[model samples]
Target: MAALAPTAQAGQGDESRLPKAHSWRQWLDREAWRKAIIAIPYLWLLFFFIAPFLIVLAISAGTSQVGIPPVIWKDTFPFGTFDNYVFLTQDDIYWQGYLNSLRNAAISTFFALLIGYPMALGIARASSTWRNVLLLLVILPFWTSFLLRVYAWIGLLGNTSWFNRGLTSILATFFPFWVTGDHIQMMNTNFAVVLGIVYSYLPFMILPLYATLEKLDRTLDEAAMDLGSKPWEVFKDITLPLSLPGIIAGAMLVFIPATGEYVIPSLMGRGDSPMIGRVLADEFFQNRDWPVASAVAVALLAVLVIPIMIYNFFQAREARRGST
Candidate 1:
């Protein structure tokens, strides 16, 4: 009886171990690697974006104070008394900031497209050696610090600078009276801001455009040309349509950052009604109004993210329809 009892106990232990071994095998399934790899980006976004957003949102609901942190976190509501948002509506500065930022960003994006499209097209058409050289030239500015590039523009556009002096000399031939000033009023204006933005972000616009243009089927262009299509017609009909994705991508890249830009506009633009980023900075640092700053930050996020989300939704819908 004792021997039988021992055998029964051994049999129970073996059965118990079987499930654990099966679970261990299942855990090592091929899909486990894929899941781990796919989790990386999601984890990155969660940590960088979601966590910081929640912290900011919490602070937005708090009242401003004369403290080191300058914010009084509230457990009441994550959006404060909503007075900050109301204040934004009541104030002209906030509206001006938003409008000016959008206008500048849009204008810069347009100019970038006009300049970048031809460059991208030429690069795409170039031989491999020239293509590499041109690409290096395009990205060479990035080797220097961005701040240094913007400061270089400052020197070039400043009232007493030789570049402006030369520009004045050239313009005097066309408009002698208007060019009476020693240097053009290029600096301390939206022109400088736009120029800075375009210079800094033009590479962003070019790279994506080049990527798209390079992938286009040369045969289609050749066929169209053979059928008595003029170069302009072929480009307008075929090239433009195919490169729309790159255009949109480049525009978004330029527009989004330019809208929130602080340095260029602050250094060069009129300060009476600065961009939203400048406004947000002033509220936080100068005004010591943390709650208002947070509100501005949140509204800025919404302004940027909401449109993107809606656009993505519609795009996904279109893609699904096309797939169907």
Candidate 2:
């Protein structure tokens, strides 16, 4: 009876040593690695993107003062003043800058799309060897520094540049009266800015369009042709509609950043024509008006975000329809 009792006690002790179902550490050990990997991107966005945006939003709602951190926090609704936003409307410079930014961005995007769509289409249709070569050329500009590329344009467009001299000489032969100078006088103009923007961003417009177009079923076009559809008609019905997603993606990529661009405009645009980014920089640094700068930043975000959100909503709807 005593030996049996000892064996029973040992059995109970072995059962107690086994891991319990409700053990937190055991559950954590099972899920921690899998979850951690999945959470990486979300964690990155929370720390980098969301945190910075929230900080900017907080600063935008604050007041400007003479301090290390110029924006002063206020413990009230409508935070500091609506004055900053009001100033945007009242001041002509801000209005002009905003308008110019939009105009330049729009023009640049149009040119990029016009040029890129064909290039992308060609790449999509080309043989594998030629596709690689064409893609390399499209991406070749990125190998050099962006600042260096812009600087190169400065040399090319300068009044005394060989390019301008040659252009002027060519024009002189045809329109002799109009060619009054040795140079073409293209530097520091809106045209220069647009040219620089298109050159820099063309690849961005091309790559997405290529991806979309490459995946398109060649059979669809052939089928349409068999049904007596003309080439242009088939393109209008099949190609354009199918490639819209890429078009929207490329346009947004170009327009959003181009609208807020400072460097290209600073280097290429006339002194009188300022963009919104330059104005934001001036407000923050030169004027020492953090509140106003923050307000401008916030407003710009709003303008850009609304269109993106609308696009996303429609895309979601389309996706849902497709699934259904």
Candidate 3:
């Protein structure tokens, strides 16, 4: 009985110590590895993404001294004044440029949405093998230089170019006095600028819409049809609602950058149609007013950030609901 008691006590002691068998050193080693893996991406983002933005913010707030040095930081931060913004608001040319930019960007975004939606829908409905080919074709333009593409537009719209001449000649042959050189000057017009923007940013709209639409169930549309809903009704009820996130995302992608687009306007727009982007460039280089240029950039950023945050919030909420 005494020997049996000693054996039972030994068993109890071993059982009591089993949970603590994992040492603090082993636990720490495992945790350290986990933490390192998690921290690497955040560290990279902080250094690359956050740091660059902070620097830009700093520069935008500071004053620029042209001859002595390029930029000189004021003793007071944000300069504690609205001089930059004030200058922009008071100037008639600057205000006109701002309004022109908004109009061009909004119109371009609308046209891009209209053109891209059908193409995206067709691609989503295509067979798997064909879909890849279609997607490849859609993205193919991006591989070519964007600057080269804009330059190509210049040739297409130039006064003595094939397109303009062909149209004028055809109109003259058919309608005689109906169309003339003065009337057909597509080159360096607002129309040309809008067309260029739509052509360039169409891909941004297509890709996102494709992403959302492809994942949608085809039966939803079929069910709508089965219930006697018209094609437009089905789109309004099911398709549009489901695809709202993509639409918003695509619009934002095009609209935000289009607001600040310099190349398209510079290449395609009339000199009289001064956009905010061109104004910013002229301020920086031609006028040599670095402080004003920085102010413009900062203002642009401020205008864009709020809507983007709201969009992200709604998107996240919708995604969560979909998952559940």
Off by over 4 Å in 3: 1-45, 73-80, 169-178, 310-324
* Candidate 1 Cα misplacement greater than 4 A, ranges: 1-29, 73-79
Off by over 4 Å in 2: 1-34, 75-79, 176-180, 318-324
What clash pairs does model 3 have? Answer: none
Candidate with the larger lDDT of 1 and 3 = 1
lDDT of 3 by residue, 224-250 (tens): 989999999999999989998789889
Clashing pairs in 1: 61-80
- Local distance difference test values of all predictions, in order: 0.90, 0.90, 0.85
Candidate 1: tens digits of C-alpha lDDT, residues 1-324:
777987777888688654565665676676677789899999999999999998887667678888778887556544357777888899999989999999999899999999999999999999999999999999999999988888999999998999999999999989997778667889889898899999899999999999999999999998999999999999988899999999989999999999999999999888777989899999988998988888889998889889999999999999999998
TM-score of each: 0.89, 0.86, 0.81
TM-score winner between 1 and 3, please give it.
1
Question: Would you give me the overall lDDT of model 1?
Answer: 0.90
Q: Candidate 2 on 105-129: residue-level lDDT in tens?
A: 9999999999999999999999999
